[model samples]
Target chain A: MADVVKFDEHPSDTLRAGANFNLAGIDPASTPGYSGDKGAGESLLSELDGKLTQLQEQLFAESRTGGKKRVLLVLQAMDTAGKGGIVNHVMGQMNPQGVQFKAFKAPTPEEQSYDFLWRIEKEVPAAGMVGVFDRSHYEDVLIHRVHRWADAVELDRRYRAINEFEARQTAAGTKIIKVMLHISRDEQQQRLLARLEDPSKRWKYSGNDLKERAFWDDYMDAYQAAFERTSSEHAPWHVIPANKKWYARIAVQQLLLDALNGLALQWPVPEIDVDMERELVRRS
Target chain B: MADVVKFDEHPSDTLRAGANFNLAGIDPASTPGYSGDKGAGESLLSELDGKLTQLQEQLFAESRTGGKKRVLLVLQAMDTAGKGGIVNHVMGQMNPQGVQFKAFKAPTPEEQSYDFLWRIEKEVPAAGMVGVFDRSHYEDVLIHRVHRWADAVELDRRYRAINEFEARQTAAGTKIIKVMLHISRDEQQQRLLARLEDPSKRWKYSGNDLKERAFWDDYMDAYQAAFERTSSEHAPWHVIPANKKWYARIAVQQLLLDALNGLALQWPVPEIDVDMERELVRRS
Candidate 1:
């Protein structure tokens, strides 16, 4: 697998299940892909801008035609884990028209009435586009298991259901990149404190965040189990150590580039008579 | 009414009914408040970036506190009239977390089952947020009326329902800025041709675009009636001359700033003691 086509930051297959994919073993502060400072990351980001935009444009251009594949970057992270930052910095660099961002907050009454994957399925990216899910169906397993809302059997069933759901998306034309932005317990505390002190950031500080922090160990355990049950080659999870925000962002950008580059996308051909259309436009 | 506040480019009340507001009199090629080229407009946009970003952050921060108000910039335009451009260039300058952008397409089977405003009401920006509806409930009137999908009475009723809906939203702390991005017929032809010729843009073209062009006069008439019937003091529609895309973008940005300025919004105070929270976070 390592000998395959390169990603500047190839997602570690260590994240692949039944392998050594333990959440605890991975240090949150490590920068796995690049040894760049913020300035270097920003510069690299600038360089990738045109390529990323072009790739996205081609993908959108080809979509709705037959044999189109889309990318769904499913972002799962603990609260205050820079999910929004990635959306702003990395994904923001792309054409907003070509991308879809759905930040799934707590489900609504209407959403709760349906099964978990029902809402998730409705939001899958259309062919030839990039779809981003801030928190995804995995919330069902992670939070539900952490809170003991689901029994072991039901939990096992949901993991199976998630695997089946993702498999179907792949069978059709969706490449799923499930990224877990891994931050340590102490780092999260610093982030929470930062949010509390800054009036601008204070509103984002929810009382539930504090309560959620108390369950940190439980959440970690749930995440470990999730990897054990759900990670696969088809929908592989990349556990990106995210303590340095810049590294997490660059790693995610590389993941998207790898996915898009693998597609061998082409600029779509004109289905209409271009010369005639150009003449008409000239005449008008 | 004009004495209370200022907008760098205040929206024209010529769009208001029983006033000078008439669709045909306004030339689409005219730049209403701007006397600048694209370069100049881009510079102005850059200058406004920090202010807009700050205002949006304050708006979002002020929200969740009681008595907070929100802004909903309802954008209605003819196809290819630069709605997406305004979204990416103007509103995109703000915090994406604080702004909700919903491009309302054709209603689905489930959506058609309910009232036109049902799905709309679901996506209204929470307090302190700025919501952009690319094509809103107005579509039920614009496209529907142009095609005679609804009869005279039904059409009249939908307009009334829309006005009432705006009133309700205004009563509940949502300030509505309804804008019509008015582009000339020839401009549409040019834009459509550009899309057809450019491979990257080809995907955006549709056969229906030509079908729709055939009904241009009818759409113009439909829009005239829509303005006369529905533009209210509670929610005024700004008819922006959009053939000059730069002017349209700047004007929209100014309108948003005016809306935020009118609020006299302050940063929210903490419900709990800030000092205690800081101490607690320090301890943690």
Candidate 2:
């Protein structure tokens, strides 16, 4: 019943695709597909929660019966673009048992010794799971390009490697939902200041965060380059305007809903004889 | 404010410790500690959600600054006793980013090759995480003892190994909450029947479940033996009456809240110069 509640515009279509996409054209504060105000958005989200939970359970059940299909949500964003908020509000609504969440930090010495995707390959969600990457293999291209850690040839090679990697995942029954949470520099400053002002939030503030703010333009360019190279038909990037935290949360929730719905998931058939089991249970 | 709302008796005290514990003495249908009716209990649980979320966030924040304190909830129960429900309703309320959930099944050949504690040690909560085990190393004792897979000597060795492993974890600042969700045989039958009749829930039913039910008394004995030998000051086993799903959920939530509250967690001091960072953010 909740799935019948429709948006004026489907976020999946409006938000998807990165080819010839311009970062400046999108407004971070706008709610694109959702028509309602904050209260309605929140209400619809609560309604959608039940549907999402059921779909996820079906997926997990399917996995138990040798279903290989799973979902991987790849989140790439700058500092304070509300990636954690999305994880908390959207992905957090699902059963934690069915969700595999991994936050990738800078590579360690051992990780640096291997290809960038080696550590990532280790954390992929198994059959019937919804895997979430807080910051994923995209960083190898985004951050590396910003700092010129790799030459154009190597950067280009990394982009090809990423596309190939994602294609392989899609071929193996993984539906990859790649998202870029787009937030403005002004919004980042405001968020950072809020973190600095509140003692409870101060722990999140760091000197490096401010230092990173100085490279705002360079990071934007890096993101655009990465998008142009890696976004493909199998795994298109969805640029979510994340300045309004509520809007971003709802939009991402919609994207996940669509992904799960696209799977047309149904509960797996019971492997046992129901009549015999029922009789046995009754006698016992 | 929610924490100020008190139970008639603290579940932490009422349900804790297994010394001379009688599994049959506790009524599965009775609501222990909580004095409220179902409606009131559900309301109180909704209220407690905020408190639990804040406490978990503080634990996670502490970990960012080298705080080693963490909590591990180990849930063990019979089939259809609601281990998954507790995880969905209780642990599901917290941010998934801070919750580490692992469900143990029959060990694979690789897992069986290692010491029983080896697989468990790998899944322990890192600093500032709330780790949950759906079923854990206790299976080595419970299932093994019930089926006579191991003799008295090996079972005794395993109990000691589990105790020592938990002691080391506590020494390293992990607070372990071990819970056994106790349900009546009649309740399990009703639950299995409901699963058998509902097509949506049929995937959860297996013929093996009915087979396991025949050994109910043996499983009970094995559980009691596990509690006597393994429960300790650092890691105590709390047997929760789970016939009423609401009571079991809130009682477990209270146990987790008490564990986190006992830690006396505080937000870590900001490592950067606050005024300087604020001014820099303003400039940016």
CAPRI-style grade of the A/B interface in model 1:
acceptable
Best by lDDT: 2
Question: Could you give the CAPRI-style class of model 2?
Answer: high
Candidates in order, TM-scores: namely: 0.86, 0.97
Clashing pairs in 1: B14-B21
C-alpha lDDT of residue B84 in model 1:
82
What i-RMS does each candidate reach, in Å?
A: 3.0, 0.8
Task: Judge candidate 2 against the unseen true structure and give its global Cα lDDT, from 0 to 1.
Answer: 0.90
Please tell me what DockQ candidate 1 reaches.
0.34
Off by over 4 Å in 2: A1-6, B1-6
Q: B108-224, model 1: which lDDT tens digit per residue?
A: 999999999999999898887788998999999989999989999999899999999999999999988989999999999889888976767877777677778778899999988
True-vs-predicted CA distance for residue B155, candidate 2, Å: 0.7
lDDT of 2 by residue, A14-101 (tens): 9876567887789988888777777777778888889889999989999989999999999988898999998898888899999999
